[model samples]
Target: MTIRSRLLLTAAIGMAQPALAEVTLTRGSSPVPDGEALSTGDLTVQNEHLAFTIAVDSQAPWGVPRGAIVDLAPVTDGEIALDRIAFADFIPNNWSAWPNTGREVEIVTETPEKVVIRITRDFGEADIATTYTLEEGSDRIHLVTEMTNRGDVPLVDQMSGFTLWPDSGYILPVPGLAGVDSGSAEDALSDRVVAYDEDWFIALHAPYFDRVEYASKDLYATHTLAPGETRSFEGWLQVGPSGDLAPVVAAEIARGDIAAGSLAGQIASTSGPVEDSVLVVEKEGVPYIWTLTPDGSYEIDLPAGDYSVYATAAGYSDSAPQQVTVAADGSETLGFEDLKAPGLLDFAVTDSAGEPLDARITITEGQAPLVEFLGRQTFFTELDQVGGVQASIAPGDYVFTVGHGTGFLTEGEEVSVSVASDETQEVDVALELIARPYENDWYASDMHHHADQLEGTTPPEYVARSELAAGLDVIFLSDHDSTANHGALAEIAEMRGVPFIPSAEFSPSWGHFNAYPLSLGEPLEIDTSTATAAEVMAEARRLGADAIQVNHPFIPYGYLASLEAGTVPGGFAPDFDLLEMNGPDDDDAVFARAAQFWTQGQRIFLSAGSDAHDVWNDNTGSARAYVHVPGGVSADGFVANLKAGRAYVTRGPLIEPEIMFGTELRIAPDEERSLSFDLTAVNGLATASLIGPDGEISSQSFDKAPSTATAEFSITATPRTEGEDWVALRVEDTAGKTAYSDPIWINPLGEPDVLSQD
Candidate 1:
């Protein structure tokens, strides 16, 4: 029998529970029954326990075409637990166009007891049909997807699955692993993964697959399909109270008929059982971790396979790997022995003031034990610790490096010391302050940053720590499409005595914008779905945003590109306050675009940001803006100064112009004035140039120059035929670092300037 007939018969026989399933269609602000097709409204399926809302079209706030689950909430408390969820990114042709492609939705089966909605979308050579089902008295939603190869070529490396954006929290749990770091996908142990918080939990279960792949919030499985072949896969989305995973696991095991084998063992050394030991079981290069009990015993259920088992712990050396094999539904016992004792390294880092400094410490030479569960090699000194931090490492000749971020004078000081087993070594290092821009009322700010949002892996605490380690005076939180990390980031920034700005990256189909200095707890009022760029900026202003910045305007899906292509409705709106010089890599194209706007008499200022999403792999403040806030780096003062164009964008060098760019300089026609600039680079200076609307007006090249240099040139204010005339400064360091100053308006007296006309 068909699925609908089976469900209907079940309902007729009274085997189905009460008819608690409800289906609704939402268009604009009105919600109606499921059958109505009023311009592709969003569809919501809800049972007694959970509710799932799917955006039926691209006009939804999540900006995804076709059926994308945008919100999930529990019935008891109607709080959203998901930002958005979708199935995407089929490999071997790298087909990721589902979010931008149009599709059709059909209500295949609809009843009070059960409902199933089918969505179909076609690529050039492939077609996919996905069905979502909700049933009465069920806490989970079921999914079945079929992909057909329509072209003549065979599809290889075929893989696709759900991409999830939990509204908050980054704790991901898999079978045989308690807590897996979301930043890395090396430990995908099972076919199920759960993203949970304190109040709600959401899990993806694909039991047909033996292993799962997770990275940047995407969990999927791999398969292959030949030409004219069709492949079908089944999965489920389970929801539950809190973070309990027992129900999900049990259901997955029963559904998939998983015949998991058991591994039970003890970890011991020469003296006795190693109470603090952790067992690592490796199968196909994927590790399943188990923590031992107080008695040094561990038991884990694993898929039947040949495996290598070992033990590692703090203050102890790793044991040799032992190989074993198990049959299906069988049991095995394995134990490890002869773990060597460890030596301790006690280290302290201090500032020039002789006070304890919170700095990053790295083991540059010797092999450090992978004591950190995530296998991290670097360590940080705690702010609350009194004396210093201690690490138990393997006995060897190790070099320890200590320093702060790029803002500090020294990169780091390395000291080599020989250590013996079961011995303690003490080391201390002092860091000197190189340049204190804050003393001169200039604050370094990376205006764009992210935490554990979509495609981001670092948690809020780590985000704060990374930015602080970068020695930034101002911290800005601008995670994509959400402000959930603002409170946590603010608290950490307060504890660290740094200024914090609450912001969000308003992401839409056209491009992305960073709206900053928003009030805490203010609802994200701007509609990110159908709002045009002009409307988005207007909404940000209406929501009391201090500044709205166009982010990465020249890259793919960037605002400038959209405008140039005329893809954005109401194209070329000059409502934005700042334009971004994104990341550390210099983009000459972006500079040329900004200069073009400046020549067109637009006063859009330039700012810099690293756009770091994963702090574990990327630097936070690699490219930053130094804003001139005379009083301090308060949110209000910083935004005000940034809007006034009192900021310079830099990767490493620092530029101080005699008359800061963005300031109007009044001069008579045919009058000449001397322009001076002070340049400083951690690396030696290479060249400095004075730029104008026509071209480079004056320039100086330096060889073997000190870290600091001065450049002075004379500029004559000639009457412009049209538009406005402006002068800017650009400097490059020997290390290929670059800095650019905002243009200084050389306005002829009795003539209207760009800002004056505006």
Candidate 2:
């Protein structure tokens, strides 16, 4: 039977008596073989609201190929005009869609009210069963997707659910792509995964309150599943006219049908009030975490069922997760009174001038990170705001590594303090600021940063001091689509003698970009998740943005490759100035891609950022852009220098490339017979390579450690058969610290080169 005729039948029956209508499911085989489709076959589901086909092909029965959601629109009119490339499934790792290889599907049950189908692969090693149900007289379908591990190996980084790729012209309620650990109905309600398209509205309801992520045209959920365990997700997809969905969301919340429950608990082992304790609950191999107030009590809004709960603090040993059960909407109060006590360690840092200096610190237990806090803010640990460092740590020997950013170096110190239940210890360290080759004029800046804006977050003033403590001369609070903190941050930067550049991270539907030097008003008139990359760049320029940078292009929705692919409508490879070379982790792929674009004659500049959101956990300016503003550092000077390509990005080692002939820094090809630049580093260096034309043409390695090195090469005046050639340098020190210089154009001899675009 055809799906349209089945939908018409359901609608006719439901018109007589709303609640009397029942869902009907039909099984059929595609043109492809059964093994290629879902093992059992494909299933067609239809109701008044929408009609779609679920394919359980063996290649990956769990994955929904393009056009899975065949139809969706208001219940009255026939299916609205929209893209049919909607898919669903469980992704085990990153953003790449799961192929569901070596998997098969089984039809568990078929009824009017619900249809349950299980998709499994690897000879029953893993299984995910999804039940689709439709209510009479309603424009929504309830989906309950559950995944279980039947194999001996544990399922790592397993994230499951559906992603609907509807047509554009919709708005995401939130700024970013995802939200983690949404606790209350109001909290989840504020960030509804609903998209409004003219007269129609499509929404994804998370009744039980879990981690939900949605783009302009996509919706999905993620969680890990373990061996012999199952992780279930409950939500509803509502499609109807544009109006209030509060009632639908509220009803779902009250139903308490979601997978997890609420866990309320308290911290009991601290000496005083339990300020700043983290509660972690792991259920079915999925962990839900919450940060509680410094007070003695806490609450876990959504606790996965049959989970273990624990508490952890800076210096205290983590309390093992105790197994507990929490019912939906029901609460379970738990406590941690036996958490291992920790010795208090205090720090006092100073500069060579005997003055206090805020220092970036790393406290390691053995060699691993002692504490890595999560929940979307800054993660680097710094002592600038607190004016000192203090920790409550388990009584054990640890190494306290300290260094002032860029200009100073301080060695690590071994600390051993024993405490009997309660005791305090103190330590002191001084970082000596050594003279560098370019400290006189070059200034460092962390161009991308975010502060705690959710609730009870540190003020922007404190964050400003943290930037200063990290030895940053300039800072840009490029919060996600909001400049609410920039005003206060600018004031604080003034007082702290640091230049604050006003900027916002333009989150276009295609990718993320950062626009700088914004004006005070109702924010930029650009909705990144809905607008195209070209439209976003045009809008930024119209709004007087001095520059726009592509941020973290290696991330999930990075625009570089997407634009090249032309997958997103209205998206094109717009000419953007600076490309981000640094993020939370190292991505050589992004760096390599940027180089490929540059070598292909795209006039791209290089920039780096710490991407620091949490000051205490993230190094504010770990990866910084050193801009050479020879005259003085001003707002305009900073931006102009960057646009002019007078900058180099660095993490630890310092690299500067100077194309010199006689006394000139920039030489014309007619005068570029030979050029040389001195590469200097504070650390012992081993090798330096000069990159040009085809690739690394020349390289030098040092037998003995040298504080400085030089690379010289002859520039050819030959006419090239390809695009323009360029030159740059990459240097690495004995400590493995490396830096890449901004590329300098090696123009063809006698060719008239346009130096500036503006």
**Best candidate (score: lDDT):** 1
lDDT of 1 by residue, 1-758 (tens): 32234334755765544444454333442132221112346677766667676667434433344465656655544333333233222222222212234578898877776788888766447777788888876777888878888889976765565555554544354544443333333444566666654345677776555334333345555667788998877777877754434455445545666655666788888878877576766666544433343467876655566888787666566788888786666778888777767777788877778877666677788755432432345666654562277877766677877766553234567778776678988888787755667777878888888887665667887777667667678888887767778888888778877788898888775678898887774666655655667888887776678888888887545788767756575577778888898944435666776777788988788888888876655677888888888877787888888887888888887777778668887777787788888777777788998888887898998879567788888888888887789988888888788888888888777443233412
Off by over 4 Å in 2: 1-346, 366-398, 406-425, 434-438, 453-459, 520-522, 573-575, 583-602, 660-684, 704-722, 734-737, 747-758
Largest TM-score belongs to which candidate? 1
TM-score of each: 0.69, 0.57
TM-score of 2: 0.57
**Model 2 clash number:** 26
Question: lDDT of candidate 1?
Answer: 0.67
Query: Each candidate: what lDDT?
Result: 0.67, 0.55
Candidate 2 global lDDT: 0.55
